[model samples]
Structure formats: structure tokens, C-alpha cells
Target chain A: MRIVVLAGGIGGARFLRGLKSAVPDADITVIGNTGDDIHLFGLKVCPDLDTVMYTLGGGINEDQGWGRTDESFTVKEELAAYGVGPTWFGLGDRDFATHIVRTQMLGAGYPLSAVTEALCDRWQPGVRLLPMSDDRVETHIAITEAGTGERRVIHFQEYWVRLRASVDAEAVVPVGAEQAKPAPGVLEAIAAADVIVFPPSNPVVSVGTILAVPGIREAIAAADAPVVGLSPIVGGAPVRGMADKVLAAVGVESTAAAVALHYGTELLDGWLVDTSDADAVAVVEAAGITCRAVPLMMTDPEATAEMARAALDLAEASR
Target chain B: MRIVVLAGGIGGARFLRGLKSAVPDADITVIGNTGDDIHLFGLKVCPDLDTVMYTLGGGINEDQGWGRTDESFTVKEELAAYGVGPTWFGLGDRDFATHIVRTQMLGAGYPLSAVTEALCDRWQPGVRLLPMSDDRVETHIAITEAGTGERRVIHFQEYWVRLRASVDAEAVVPVGAEQAKPAPGVLEAIAAADVIVFPPSNPVVSVGTILAVPGIREAIAAADAPVVGLSPIVGGAPVRGMADKVLAAVGVESTAAAVALHYGTELLDGWLVDTSDADAVAVVEAAGITCRAVPLMMTDPEATAEMARAALDLAEASR
Candidate 1:
């Protein structure tokens, strides 16, 4: 089967690792979310793309599920010593090389898609990885300071990494999404896939941001294949990351049913929720999308592969 | 007395360290050669400026006389793993931070001089550190590849570090020097100085490259202060670095008197040669520049301090 997966950062990367393990023969196309891409120390850092690349390429810190294994912080320490920062973002020496190569290629006039392909040449992530768009699309969060009641917009990374998402995100906005065209092969991948799966990633920032790219949503909605989504919110909370904060910003309840409803029947055909959120299946089914409950905690590759298998089964059943 | 020194890399940096010890209270302004600066892995690497900063700031690797002490090469190793290279350039993780900060500032539209000032704010090298030009000025060496005999120009760093100056440099060209204006504060420092010294840095690439800047040599020549130069050649050989290779490229002999003659009497008022090259003193003086012989080996800070003192003494006697 030719499968397509929309990935975010840690959670999505972990799920993709499992999906690869489950169906080794399947040709996979990963449309990585680039909204979380940031310029730190003047180098382009695509956190989500790197996470997916490293996880699948066997270079990821398995325990952290993001960044490189055996990473060193000498570069970060030296940068801080020079008083240059957004020091809150943890970029290690090994991870810095990825950004350096990306930035160098980007500076030399290669589109993000070409750069992604070039970077993947080294990682050989076993999938054709494409950024959601070649053009820049940054996710900026609108937040009001608690101490001063001052309102300001900050980059998604600053919101998540620096502030730890403590302040309530008033609005989650993908700044350049409306105008962004799908990267070169994105629409083709969606049209050609036997099944498209939204891995257990942040709905508002990850998959949602990818859909926000103008032609991508229309392509998936119009695709012949059934589209399936695994709920990032296992029960009433996110499996990892502070997805609840951004979810609330978009007026969605932090529940499997609400997340499925947010994606809607027009775009989604099947939804998978954790066994704890079994009550959400009927609610989602009533809304016209086929829903299934499964053991969704991606505790290990075996557990994640099972979740991948369940999502694929749901997609097959919907067909 | 206020002193202005035109410096290259290791030799100049070592001399500055000695000068600081020689005259602890004298205000010093160092015009660092920028022609040797190269962009590696998308980061600006200023070899001369960094050498002076690290050496004086007490952060230099004493053995290498350049780069940071207690450095790690994780970033370099990782870059090589990604197959992004000019792997010959040895930039340590700690040293990478300086380039990152510099490149970031340059990208943000700050001039190279301003970026140098910003970098020096952390180093507190005591002396004012100024790049010879805010504009890009690279020293490209014309070399005939030994095996291929392909005549092409390569960056000075590649010539120095990668080839180790084994190939004969046909010509030494400061690529952008003709149009490059003196960086801010360079002429001002020269004009206000009580005396000027050329530390035994490479005449052809170091002090020569600095003089290649449009207004710098003219400023020093017109200034009231006497300009004294210490010959890098001790007896018949360069004390450090392959000054002989570039000197040959510039059509100058690798001798103490020949180097003094290369600078010429029009710009240089006094010259200091090593006691071992005492026989060349009268030959240099015949060229219309006052000449003196002194023990010039920078074996220790004390020895280098005496050389700095000897150069200052020459400047005084000539005045």
C-alpha cells in the first residue's frame, strides 16, 4: 500500500516510526508540518521535519523522542556566552549541523522541498518527506501576559518552549497559511495514496497547519482514498505536549470527539481514539465519520505499530 | 602612548598579547585583517579578528594560538556526517558560536565592524578590535594544483589550512580590497594614535591585506605618528606560518631586508629586524626607513614584550 502521513514533531514522529515498522513494504510519503520551523541563531531550524528525520533515520534521542542521540551543548553554551539567544530552545551540536546544511542550501536558492530532499539523502528516512509548503508559514500564538495583562504575539516555539505554554493562548494563527501553496509533491501524494493517516500529533498546530496550506485540505478532501486520524488527546488530555492549550485557543474541547468533529466529516472519513475515550466513538459516528477505540498510548514501537495497524484497519473499513 | 597595530592571525595576536604586557596602560587599537575571513558552513569565520580576540581574552588554545580553549568538535563531526563540508577547516563547537553570532548580526544588517565590536564586548580583549573593512574582502590565492596543474584561485583559508601552502601561490589577490573602505573607527584610530606598529605578522597576507583597504594605508602615511614594522622573517625564514609562500607570490624575497623593502619607505618610517638578521639592518636603512636589530623570537610573553618595546623604541627614535 502507498500510504501518506501528515506529521508534526515528537508524537507524529514516534507514530511514523511505528507505521514504518508495521508496513515495511509500503511506500510512505510524509508531509512534514513546516509552520513550527523557526530561525534560531540565524539558522533555519525545522523542528518537526528534523524530529521525523532523526526518529526514522535512527539518530533521534529515543528517550526525548526529539533531537539527536549523543548530542552535545557546547554550541548552545558558547552562543549564550556571546549573549545571542532564544536560549530557551534546546539545540544541540549534532542538531545544529542539520540547520546549518538547511540554511546553507536555502541561502543558495534551493526551495525548502529540495533542501528537505537533500537533507533526507543523508538520513534516508525510508519515506519521501515533503514540507507542507516551500514558502514560509510560521505559527504565531496570541497571548496575554498574566502579570501586566499585556497582549502580544510570539512565535509558536517561543510560546511552547520558552513560556512552556503557561499563558493561555488567545489565538493560534498560522501566519502565512492562507497564501501558501502545497509543496511540489504534496497534492500528488494525497491524490495517489491508498490511505492517508493523521498521526497522534497536535491538531491545531501540526495537522491543522498542514491543512491550512491552501490546496492541501482541498486535495485531501477530494482525494479518492479514505482519510483516517488518530486522536492526540487520549481521553481529556494530550498524550504528549501541551496540545490542550492551543486546542482551547481554537475553541475545541480537549477531547477525542471534539478533535474529530473539528477535522469534520468533509475532510475525515475515519477516527481512532484511545480505549479510555471509547465513549467518543458513538459521538463521532453520529457525526457521520466512522470511529474506533484502541490502545493509543505509544509507549513503545510495538504499541505504536498496533495504533498504526488500527488506524489502517479503520481506513480499510471506511472504504 | 596610544598605539595602533595592524595585525593578521597568530603572529599578530601573540604580539598584541605581548604589547599588552609591555605597556599595560597604553591605549591600543588593533586593525585586524579581514581578507582571511571565510564563510564556512554558512557562518562567517574571521580568523585574524578571532585570533586577536581569543588570544587577548585568555580563551585561545595556547598550542594552536587560535580558536577557543577547552573546545569540542561535535558540530564539525556532525556536519561531516551530513556530508556538508570543507572538512579541512577546523572550527570547534565553542568557536562556532562566535561565527553564529557574527553571521546573525551581519544578516540583521549590522556592519562587520559593528559585529566585531559586539563580539569584543564579551571578550573584553582590552584593546579596541576593528576589522579593516566592514565590506567583504577575501584573500584568494592563485595556485597551480600539483597533480592537475589546473590554475585557479582558491580562498586563502583553503590555501593555508587545506593545502598547507604546499603548492606555490602564483599571486595573492585581496578580492574586494580595491573598493573596500576602511571600517568605521579605523582611520580615526590611525589618525589619533601616538605611534603605530606592525607586529611580526605575515607581510604579504596580513599587514599587506590591511594596507590593501582603500583609505587605511593613506591614513597611516598621512598621520603625524611614526609607523614602525617588525619583520616576520627572523634571519632568513618566517618565524611562524607560510609567509614565504605568499611573499614569493608578491615577488618579494623571504629575507628580513626584503620584507622591509616590500612595505617600502613611503608608508613605513621605521623597521625592526631580529638581532640574528643584524647584517640586514644597514640594507633596510638604505631604503630610507630607520632600522634597528633586536631579539625577535616570541619564545614567551616576556620575549615578545621586549620585541614590542623594541618596535616602540624605533617609532620614538624615528619621531
Candidate 2:
């Protein structure tokens, strides 16, 4: 089966690792979100893409679920000594080189999509990793300050990292989404996919940003493929990340049913909710999308592969 | 006495350590050559300036004559894994961070002089280190291929790090020199100096590149200061580096007298040669410049300081 999985960072990377194990023969094409990309110390760091790449390439620090294993901080310390900006992001020395190479190639006139392919050439994640678009689409969060009524837009990292999502988010906007065209192979992959699975990633920022690009949602809806989404919310709380805070910014409740309804039956043919969210299945199925209750915890690769199997099973049933 | 020193990398850095010890109170400003600077992996690397900084800051690796004492290479290995470009240069993980910070600051519209000041804030080299210019001025060397008569210009790093300067140099050109301006404080430092000393640095590439800046040479000559140069060549050979090879490219002999005549008394008031070239003193003096024969070996800091003092004494005598 040709499966195209839309993903974010940690959870997505882990889930993809499982998917690879679950369906080794399945041609997987991952449409990774670049909304969290930041230019730190003159290197373009794509947090989501690297997370997926490293995790699948077996180089990720399994404990942190971000950055590479056995990474050093010599470069980071030198940068701090020079008083360089944005020292809070924790970019490890080994991690920095990846960004450097990516930024260099991008500066030399290669689109991000092409750069991703070149970077993936060595990783050989067994899945074709494609950035949602070649054009820049930064996710900005509109937040109300502690003392002010005015809502201001901040870069996703500033919102997620610097602020730690402390402020009240009014809205989340993906800047440049209006003009961003899907990457060269993105639309084709979505249209030709036999199964389109949305990993348990942040809906408001990860998969949402991918769907925000022009014509991507339309292509998926029009595809003959069975579209399935796994719930990132278990028992009304996110597996990781500040998904609830972002979901609140978009007026969506932190529940499996709410996320399914947010994506709607227009694009999704099947939905997989955690066993803890078994009660949400009826509400989601009432909206004309097939629903299943499965053990969705990705505590290990085996568990994650089982989750991946559940997603495929849901797609198969709906088909 | 105020002094301006033209410098290159390791040797220049080591010599400056002694110069500082010799004249503890003399106001010294180092005009570092930016010709050796290269943008590797999207980070601006000022190798010469860094050598000076690390050496004076007491963070230099005494054995390697470059990089930090406790440096690591996690970043470099990671970069190689990613198949990034230009892996030949000894860029340690800690060193990469310095370049990243510098490149980011440069991209943010800060002049290199100001950035150098900020970087020096931490190093506290005591001597003010200024780049030749804020603009890009790369040194390109023309080399004849062994198999073919075709000659091509390559960046200084490629010539030095990759080829180890093994090829016959046809010509050495500092690209962008015509349009490049002397970095801020460069002219002022020269003008305000009691004496200007050229440390036993590479005369052709290091010191030559500093003088190549539009107004620097003229400023030193117009200033009410004595300009003295210590020969990089001793016993008819360069103390370090292939200075003779590059000297040949510029049509100048590697002899101390030939180097003195190349600079001329038009810009220099005094010149210092080693005891081995004591006989050449009259030849250099005939050019209207005071010449001194000193034990110009900087085998240790005390000896280097003695050499620095000799240059100052010659400058005062000429005045």
C-alpha cells in the first residue's frame, strides 16, 4: 500500500518509526511540517523534519525525542560566548551541522523540497520525506499579553519556546499560507496515495499547517485513497506538546471527537481514537466518518506499530 | 607607545602574546586579514581573527595552534554524516558556534568591526582586533595544474587546507579590495600610533592583505608614527607557512632585505631583520628606512616581547 503520513516532530517521528515497522512493504511518503523552522545562529533549523529524519534514521536521542544521540554542545557554548541570539533553543553541536548544511544548500538556490531530498539521501528513512511546500510558511500565534488587551503575533518558537505558551492564544496563523504552493510531489503523493494517515500530531500547527497550504486539502479529499486520522488527544489531554493550547486558539476542544469534527468527514474517511477516548467514537461516527477505539499510546516502537496497524485497519474497514 | 600590528593566524597569534608581554602598557591594535575568511556551511569563519582571539584569551589549543583547548568535533562528524560541503577545515564543534554567531550577526546588519568588539568583549584580548573590512574581500590564488597548463583561482582555504599550498602559485589576488574600505578604527589606530609593527606574519598574504585595504597603507604612511616590520623569513626560509611560494607570486624574494624594499620607506620608517641577515642592514638603510638586526626568533613569549621592544626602539630612533 502507498501510505502518505502527515507529521510534526516528536510524536510524529515516533509514530512514523512504528509505521515503518508495521508496514515495511508499504511505500511511505511523509509530508513533514516546517512551521516550527527557525533560523538560529544563521542555520535554518527545521525541528519537525529533523525529528522525523533522526528518529527514522536511528540517530535520534530516544530519551529527549529531539536532537541526535551522543550530541555535543561545544558549538552552542561558543555561540553563547560570542553572545549570539536565541540561546534558549538547545541546538546541540551535532544538530547544528544538519541545519548548516540545509541552510547552505537553500541559500545556494535549492528549494527546501530539494534540500530535504538531498538530506534524506544519506538518512534513507525508507520513506520519502517531503516538506509540505518549498515556499516559506511560518506559523505565528496571536496571544494576549498578561497586562495588555492587544493580541500580537509571535513566531511559533517564540510562542512555544520563549514564552512556553504562557500567554492566552487568540488565534494561530500560518503566515504565507495564502501564497504557498504545495511542494512539487506533495499534491501528487496525496492524490495517488492508497492510504493517507494523519499521525497523532498537533492538529492546529502540524497537520493543520500542511492542510493550510493551497489545494492540499482539496487534493486529499478528491483522492480515491482512504483518509484516516489518529487522535493525538487521549482522555482530553495531549500526548505531548501544548496541543490543547493551540487547539483552544482555533476554538477546538481537546477531545478526539472534536478533532475528528474539526477535520470533518469531507477529508477524513476514518478516525482512530485512544481506548481512553472510546466514548468519543459514537460522536465522531455520527459525523459520517468511520471511528475506532484502539490503544494509541506510542510508549515503544512495538506499541506505536500497533497503533499504525490500527490506523491501517480503520482505513481498510472504511474502504 | 601605540602600535598597530598586521597579523595572520597561529604564528601571528603566538607572536602577539609576546608583544603583549614586552610592552604591557603599549596600546596595540591588530589589523587582521579577512582574506582567509570563508563562508562554510552558511557560517562566516574569520580564521585569522579567531586565532588571535583564542590565543590572547588563553583558550587556544597550544598543540594545534588553532581552536579551543578542550574542543570537541561532534558537530563535524554529524556534518560529515549529512554529507555537508568543505569538511577539510579543522572546524570543531565549539568553533562552529563562533562562526554561526558571527554569520548571524553579520546577516543582521552589524559591521564586522562592531561585531569584533562584541566578540572581544568576552575574549578581552587587550589588543583591539579589527578585520580589514565589513565587506567581503576574499583572497583567491591562481595555481597551475600539474597535468594541464590551465590556471584557475580558488579560495584561500581550498589552497591552504585542501592542497596545502603544494601547487605553484601564479598570482594572488585579494578580490573586492578595490571597493573595500578599511574597517572602522583602522585608520584612526594607525594615525594615533607612536609606532606600527608588522609581526613576523606572512608578508605576502597576511600583512599584504591588510595593506590592500584602500586607505590603510596611506593612513600608516601619513601618520606621525614609525612603521617597522619584522621579517617572517629567517635563515632564507619562512618561520612557518609557505610565504616564499606566495612571495614568488608577487615577484618578491623571500629575503628580509627584499621584503623591506617591497614595502619601501615611503610607508615604513624602520625595518627589523634577523642576525643571520645582519649584512643586509646597509641595503635596507639605503632605502631611507632605519634598519636593525635583532635575534628575531619568537621561540618563546620573552623573546617575542624583546623583538617587539626592538621594533619600538628602532621606530623612536628613526623619529
Maximum-lDDT candidate: 1
Docking class of 2: high
Worst 10 residues of 2 chain B by lDDT: B93-102
Question: DockQ for each of the predicted structures, in order?
Answer: 0.91, 0.82
* Pairs that collide, model 1: none
lDDT, candidate 1, B59-119, per-residue tens: 9999988888999999898889888898999999999999999999999999999999999
Candidate 2: regions farther than 4 A off: A147-151
RMSD of 2: 1.8
Instruction: Tell the DockQ for candidate 1.
Output: 0.91
Candidate 1 residue-wise lDDT at A297:
97
Model 2, range A1-319, lDDT digits (tens) per residue? Answer: 8999999999899999999999999999999998888777767889999999999988899998999898767777777777666777888877877888899899899999999999888888889999998988899998887777766888999999898888877889899988999999999999889999999999989999999998999999899999999999999999988899999988999999999999998889999999989999999999999999999999988999999999999999999
> Against the hidden reference, what TM-scores do the models get?
0.99, 0.96
For model 1, the superposed segments whose C-alpha errors exceed 4 Å read none
How would you encode candidate 2's per-residue C-alpha lDDT over B1-319 as one tens digit per residue?
7888888998789889988998888788999989898887777899999999999998899888888888888878877887776779888877777777677778889988888888889899989999878888999999987778778899978988898889977899999988999988888888888778888888878989988989988888798877888888887888888898899999999899999998887788889999999988999998887898999888777888888788888888988
